[model samples]
Target: MTKSFRNLIWAVLLVTISCSDAPKGETKTASLPVYKDVPYLQDYSIKYNKQGDKLMLSQVFMDRNEVIQVASSEGILRTHDGQFLYPGVLLQDKTYRPLTDKNITAITIYKDQFVYLDDKAVLSNAWAGSLYLKHDLPKANVFAAGNDFEFLISDGPMLQYVSKNKKNWTGVLDKDKVKAIKFNKKNSTFWILGEKSIASFNPKGQTLKTVFQNGNFTSFALLHNKLILTTLDGYLEVDATTGKQIGEKKTKLPWTEITYVDVIDGHLWFGSTKGAFMLKKDGKFDYYYGKRWLPSNNVIHISKGTDGSILILTDAGLGQIVYEEMTLFDKAQYYEKQVRNRHIRLGFNATLVDMDNGNFDTGRLSDSDNDGLWTTMYLAGEVFRYAVTKSEDALQNCREAMDAMERLFSINPVPGFPSRSFERSGYKERLHDPERWQHSDDPEWDWKSTTSSDEAIGHIFAYGAMAELMDNDLKDRAIVLIDTLMSHIVRNDLYMVDFDGKPTTWGRWNPEYVNARPKMVGDRKINASNIIGMLQTAYHFTGKEKYKEKAFDLMDNHGYLDNLMWPMKDVAKAPDDADDWSKMLSESWNHSDDEMYFIGYWGLYKYAFNDTLKTKFKDAIIDHWEIERPEKEGAWNIMTALTGTQEFDLEEAAWYLREHPMDMVSWNIMNSHRKDVTFLEPNFREQTLSEVLPPDERPVQRHNANMFRLDRNYAKDGSEEFSAGDIWLLPYWMGRYLGVISAPEKNN
Candidate 1:
């Protein structure tokens, strides 16, 4: 039998199944409970400049509950200041008196009190039972507090033991120059870090011994029984008493030029010329770099804050990395506020562009080429939110975005053709792609043209979803849009024709345009998949037989089913002899197409004309998902749950949600120099590493960007901040709607 005859028979059977009690594939419900108090890292930066009244901070230490900084040359010890000041006693306030007026050469903590050595004497800030030791060690560069108000002070060569009344004892480093000093409570000795060795001074014995002699020792921190030493390159752990090498040199680090090392609360933290990092229990370092985690990349010191936070002192200022308790739902709420506050422009999800050094206040909402697609994603998210929680706020958000989408079709002259975006008139000079924008009949408006296939699929996906899961006017409105757009496409022979009487570039889905590409080309599969999904969605919502007939005609007579069913692995570079367009399209996997395909899957499988087609679409989706598993993408993994598959990488999905940095600012992130990541050879798929870095460690990007991308310095000063509307809230709300992620559990 001919293909047309076969499709006719299949269509008749579909109608019979539809009229009967045949099951329409429904999403499986899950009840995975997530609590509200789950702890996740929420990072922010506090920057300070040296030009103003802000002191040039060289050293940082936690004094009681305050983060105190000392400027050795200026003889200043005050609370460090920033745009967001650290919580503590404000020493800058007149209430907290100054310790001294003389220039301070060194400072240290003795019995929880800040002690400093000046040219005149050794003094402290302790009001009662204060310390005042008269000393002649005018060249004291470093010091550490010892027992009974005694301090072991060093001037590179000479070491003096100063007591409350006088300089009691003095010693010498025979060859090495003293760089740092730390009093070890475990040994009741002062451990000295020298330029070329490690030594200890026994205050009781008044003897200084060079415990370990090495030419590369730069810094040291005394752990319980071991001493963590730093060389110019890396760090090592050695026995405190023997000062011998504990293991092979730990040279493989985030940055090899280690500048400082310290141990706080039994955790090892390192400061390098590049950034500061902490060693986790899993042998991996939580790397903190760039302005997102530091004021400057050159880290000078690392210390534990009074509140168990890590204070990273850099050349410019301080960065405090705080861990806040928050659940995924809490983050979603935060992003929801962020979207409503700054990201919406005429109800379309928009970007804040031309920011000044990642300052959110300096940015303005801007239009984009994919405004409809982005708004569709965001609208779909709110649709799911309203469906799950019945939140009136979410319903209102959906209504606004839906109105914006509805305007895209009516604002232009082309019937049922959604514009890429619409803007107020007289912005032709400043808007993106000025040539593509055209003045509408309305004197106050202009609409962007040349809408792509992705936008069409996205619009259909959101409308179909709203029609199925929403209520009343919203459902009716969505159904009408489905019919309007699908009617236009079917009437125009499967193409979105523009006002100039031609199919828009990338809006073609006719057999001539789609089947012309090789089967291995990804556009063939994606275009076929998207159009069929759109057609299925329109037919299901509008009950339009023409949409169903066109869909089956494409699948049966035009070989669209075979085209879309091609294995994802087989999609690769086109043959060398192919046309330039085909070669360009197949050079590598387009992550944007992944976004389009997964969004299209909602319509493809959920509103299938029959259960048989639904099962086949499910298989296709799973096949694509298998290749995408390595990414561990939260959105893709959650979307895969739409097929009711048990193994959808749920843990990885949750991991992505948790690991995503709370700061969505487009900071210049650099992970290419990291030592722990396993780099992979170049390939067509653009997978840069064997394993991808956690979301917080890399640059913030939308789901359409490669997850394995290691570095992003697109704007050296970070001039843009992306909205979380489409990036974060979408996946989270989708998971909640699909029942894969449960609502926040109540505490007992």
Candidate 2:
């Protein structure tokens, strides 16, 4: 039963294979389809999905479409209701529509036209404008052998020939000297505008005759049987059929030195300014400047494809404009895709100085000083520009609000700029105060004044952003401030702003080590906030390779990077928990020192993605985020700031941002058991504007003494919102780089 059944199956397969008319010979040819000289095939390509038995083609300005079957090795075929008609050719994904489909058979694929067969297997001259419309360039094979005078323009080339009633009218008084030719259908006469003289060719007399002279004619054309000639002087129009003089009109603008003229669709478009011009049928002419439209203004050989698309050779790079309708979405999507790949990501750490609750607000959390809110205001400007280009007018109000913030920046100078002040409050003076606070005079609280680092980082970033999004007037103003700050920093050669208006070499949280002091300069390290800020500002203005080099250099020398190996010894080890020195890295008294060391590591991973440094940065970030000791909770602000990098891969960053409960808040103190401490809670009031504005203009939110805590502690059942600096950075940068936004829900 098995042997006879197998024989029967083999015989059936052979019968089917024989009837299929497969390619000849014992060996089958490669199944991959081949197409030649199709211009629009670059973006559009087709692949045969053998498993599905379908040909997938790239649709023009659309989605994918499957093909029925490919026609031949030399050409392409499309069927209407199953007839094997050579309708056109396929350039991978784009299908070129052919002129006729009645009797198409064996065909030769060409750039502009389909030199194909009728039903009788006869070669025919037929082509369609469909494929040319797709890419604006004519396919290559459209031209037959030996056609002289080819012009290459943006679209393609054109082949020109003169035919007057089937006679090659030639050899009339220096035929080679003729520069222009026109046809008068009314009288069957030809007006030849030459370099030195204008002549009229009469079909009846068959003789060379002269009418107008003086101006050297460069190019001319017959429009409605009138001879429109171009010269250095202007345009001279005459009736070619009657040989009667018409009005001679001089152009207000000088007549461009043109060499060719084409009257298409009621527009007398010609080549000049070494390019082209379109003269309206109503007698007004418009000059299109530049080779973007034409190859040259001279008769310097151009070619037109069989489908009439022009190709011209010019000095500039190839430029193309398809004479077809382009949808709005198509245009926006084109530019959007190009720019999105290069969109730079920037993240800032504002809490370098450890505040009462392991975080620092601009001033006392009780009074609304809005240093933390500035970056979001800057981000709003970016959203405004993006919205305007997209025509989303709802964002216009956001733009106006950002402008108000810029006005504040210009007027409200902190320690860095002495000329301006928002108000005479403890907040403004706190910028130069080293102590967290002091009574009345405040004695320039040194720790609070240390915020000049945070302010420099914040203001510079906002300045660059404002310059990019605003107009020239506003951008110039912002640039003045930016340049001023850069100059000041270069002059001081120090990290933080010097309180008491004197140079002091303090580095990070270390009181004895001056950042610029040569003795301790080796210990100077840039944190995530400073490094990202510098890289961003540098990238926006100079776009120099050196700025990128400096970024990579700092990341490599000071901290662990994406993939680079650093000896573990290079990292200062955590001191023994019981030792007096161990208290330096402890959350109780030394949280600020721990933050200083951790900041540089987090900044590098977020901004730099060079393959060589990625792994090392990742490992270091994971180590910092996943540490499970009790003191690690104090590291939450640093952890949250690094979360903006998204390099930790802990998956808890997103959860931590939203999970800050309403009632239970954590207090930061030198001793956990000490009642005297700073509370860290969330404050939801938009403080960015509040920082630079008067109390009357500030947005108010219900608050309590525990508002600075990460969790809600003031109200029973823990139902208060927290407005900490870290929470804002998480959602803001995440939404920016990932493009996911918690947009207000539509329809209320």
Candidate 3:
């Protein structure tokens, strides 16, 4: 036969033959469509109904398409042909029947008295028809649906329902007071709205129970047996079965309305007027507001497909997020992007050290072998150790810089030398600069040596780190340098309790600007409070009694215990005294705030073998405002409860860190352009709640800024930044050390 005739004969034979083998029972499977990102169409919404699916664009345009017919089964949007799509198991006539891709006959669309055809086979349309329900009825809002029903939130206030009957519109909500609505797809239940409360509704009970009664709810969702609510006050996740609230996180942003609520891969996604947030892995909120992801801070709607693609509707436009399995390389790159900044040092190789700013002089006063700055080396070591797996070129450059500094120390007479000035030009150019080759007396003469102590600690840490990196040769050298410095302190009994010989002398950078500030007199005295801590650290690392003795004496006998201001009392100081140079007793110190305290002490207490001191150290953890929920401010107030010896209560701190899931914050604090702004940083605000505000008013500000990364660093040109140590430290002390290291690789 001819080629054309042979092809026709094969086509006819295929058409005539039955596609299925078993006449009694055949399993059918369908593949869901992969969604791509849209340009910028705000409020792009989607909802599946009995007749078909509806897509709304910008809340002004509505498109209708036939996804499922009333006669067919209702299941997930499993697989699709060019013109038709299949869903998951369908519940019909009391029988659960699974549908497959081949079973989909035709896709249709339904609008105002008109049902469109899928002849063109487009999945969604911008606008299909008008709403004839009522002029006062709110515009159509999209909601996730299963089986026989789907929810429709109108622009007006009423939340209605569409059932399996193609043309039916059931007014499940007869009241006009409904403000927010969320469907528990897992429980197959809906949360209706009350005046200032929320009512749980199931088909069995006509009278809904008031689950939330204190304030008005803007938006809410149900996930993992809990009901997450976004209100004008804060974000709250409550027990679905009981009326009790399981987790309630408040924010600074006024959530008068929640545009959308989605529970994706166990995380609660909240879209509000302020921004879009993901309930982070740490049970805190994390904001997604950068350039690559969210187009607008104002989120109006959100939804997800069976393929795990998310459609976010913002004030500016719609964002499509396709969440697939990320490779290890992808995750590593993500973290590197977050922690590394190339703009500030685009032509250089050193990590941008944050010391020497604010009271620390922003690191500009450093004059020592400029390349010897241990803080930058420490940061480089921390970042490169992990980043080496991704980029070897970057790793080698970091290694070379470290080696050069090590050589400088080897050639110099100083025992353990610290880095001073960093060159603005490239490393090659930096090698030739006079600043890089020599040390400066100005840094020490001007009392800028406090950083020297911090840098010393960094050097010590870098030594251990380098030992891990350079195979012990450089590490041994590092240890020798460290020992040399320790010997200097030991010989001098260099406990600097006073700047000059007198207690009232002005020898250092004092926040209160007071002279000498009542130095702690000891056989061994240290001029700097920060230095004492460093001495303790040095002692811990080297097993030197002299350093330990000095540290213990400074800490226990001479009011060094009182030197660290209690965060509660200090942060509570009046706003006018916010920057007061007269406040002698304060909890915070330069660069080393509460976060540093927790990070530094976590290691210190873990090694000290003193249970009592550990308890005190933990008790001192300030539960200030969280970065995520600023409207209801406070940091992880529940972290202590979760890990400390404190009792375990569902509503307490301990339980909250593990279960009090919230979102990340949107703004940066260090770059916030104010010295006192540190008080508002997530770490300060959340961990030190008692000091953040008065006791009587604490409740209102408890959950504000729930999404902040407190210990995070940012770039001068405005970009995201974090620290490897922070990643390792936050999770480690919070009893999530495994979580921190394995976080990127964890299965969703």
Candidate 4:
């Protein structure tokens, strides 16, 4: 044959091989569109203090740039350097410049200028304006500004209306004291709030009209010609023109000690002695309390801020709830930064502990009982992120986290046994569960023993993902780790033999121990599911027939298939005749086991030896996801999307990610006192409410905790902050890899 013909044949053969070697199902992973600019609230605080004493913040307003300005008993102080401060004393900075040196008691925004009431006069900060009303009148307790040099002033007993620098109308309540005065632009009148009455004074007509009376009014605001009056017990809405109550008194609020009320941006906001809340369009309130959203809980005033944000002025500081427009992808990027900055310790997903009231600077990354599991989850997320984006940073993250996982096995004395965690040797006294930590061969390091099935399953899931999605060294390392772990389990008769050369508690998956539990017990089901998935992953990656044989033996002879595929509804409390261990295991649904089941599902469905078993695993995963639908867990829902199913509650998963608070500090959030939620009777699943609260509204917890939990006041003062690794990034990157969630759409 001719040399040119031979070259042509070789080129055609190379092309055919390249096409065959390309990734399979690339077209199936095509991404869709998740539009950008999704609005969500991001909160921060601006504190004002004098010599360690929290200043008494009374009123808050915004300038044209949305910079917060406060009217306190200590004059007009703004936020610290026009920036948010943490939970610490804020010394006076340049942004604390008072509009005036005089004792300003009240302030209002009139035509984008500061019109304030001082001890000597009512003055304007406008360059061309003058001090129109002077101290010739009683001390001004409250004031409101109106059209072009118009002002309504009150001093607890009488009201004075000044227009064009002259007193136009004077009004007084017959037996009440004036508390607040506001100008209604719709009718060009001054609505006066009293200690016991509501009245409107028309500056044009020079007439005063009583609107309503007989309630202890603390504050009032005008909205669409209606008046919202705050009382000691609750609040009332009154029609401005007819002087009739709009509806029944709104007493069923989060806090009833209503100190102030305002209608900002068409939303009703309330400031109680406890905190501040906004009435949502659904009639429920988005409660903001504790250090998570405020510097202190004693809110004194609320107002509209720039870009439709809410400015909550508390006795201690200003809590600005800024509604920033961002997509879920943007949130993921934010969490990515959070994890890298404060949550990584020795490449493990760690928590920042011993914080001084949620101060990130005062905390240290601490070891956890589930360090292996968390790191595995974070490693898997980075793998998926790298697969989708081909990001070099993600690849490096995967390398570091895989090194940590690999060291977990090598650090322990027992072959193929992964340690729960490891830290510097001297920290045994300071780390968690000192008894579980032992000195490794390396003098500088210590490894924790008594690892459970949770770590095993997590390691297998991550390794399987890396083996499938990564290249060269990563894939080789993952396959080797999978083989090492599965070989140890198989050789030791399906048990994670510990340093003591015995099966660790909760690491046993042998048929003898598995069949001993009652069928309804969760441990039995979780162990069976995890072992099968691990074995399948090992067989798939390592090409080990022994691993496949062990899997089939368990499923065909030991009822492992039935154990895993049993309907979730049927898994419940153990019967009275069951053993004590079984009863203890089935007392309530274990959320940790749910976490394990879903993590294992990645391997169980993806690496199933046959299409029949793959179909069965899909049914099992969807069944578990359906039972978890009420919780609206982002990780679980997104993981369920792996089954290639259309109805995986994708919207709810997006809501979970969107609603997660930017501040992860474990603050003292209390929702049990809320009146709007529908509480459910105590059930086996420990679901506290009929409907679950949003992620930010409830306590911050891992996906393994019950989402229905309504309170988390145990942290003396937000002493801990959780990492977003397993809780947030895992689901996000998994959704991106699965093509259910798209990248941020370009703004036109």
Q: RMSD for each model, in Å, please?
A: 8.7, 30.8, 18.5, 8.9
Q: What TM-score would candidate 3 get against the native?
A: 0.44
Instruction: Give per-residue CA lDDT, model 4, range 438-501, as digits (tens).
Output: 8899999898888999899999999999999997699999999999999899999999998988
lDDT of 1 by residue, 1-748 (tens): 1111211221211011111221123454332322122334454445544334454556666677464655534555454344432222223323345555466777666666667777666787675636778766787768888777888877888888888643488888878788988887776898888888888888777788888876787678877788888887787788876767798879778887888888876667889888887776567777888877777788777776666567777776667666555567888998899899889999999998888877677788888889999999999999989888889999999999999999999999989998999999987454556667988999899999989898898899899879988976999999999998888888899999987889999899999999989999999999999999999999888887898999999999999999889999999988988989999998888999999999999998888889888889989999999999999999998888788776787777877877787677788888888776678989988999898777888889988899998888864466777888889999898887776665664323
Give the residue spans of candidate 2 off by over 4 A.
1-421, 424-450, 460-487, 503-529, 532-536, 544-623, 626-654, 657-733, 736-748
The order of the candidates by TM-score, greatest first, is 4, 1, 3, 2
Best by lDDT: 4
Candidate 1's clash total is 0
Q: Against the true structure, candidate 1 has what lDDT?
A: 0.79
| Estimated TM-score for each candidate | 0.91, 0.31, 0.44, 0.92
Candidate 1: residue 136 lDDT (0-100): 66
Q: Report the candidate with higher lDDT, 1 versus 3.
A: 1
Model 4 Cα displacement at 9 (Å)?
57
Candidate 3 local accuracy as lDDT? Answer: 0.36
Query: What's the lDDT for residue 540 in model 3?
Result: 54
> Which candidate, 1 or 2, would have the higher TM-score against the true structure?
1
How displaced is residue 56 in candidate 4, in Å? 2.4
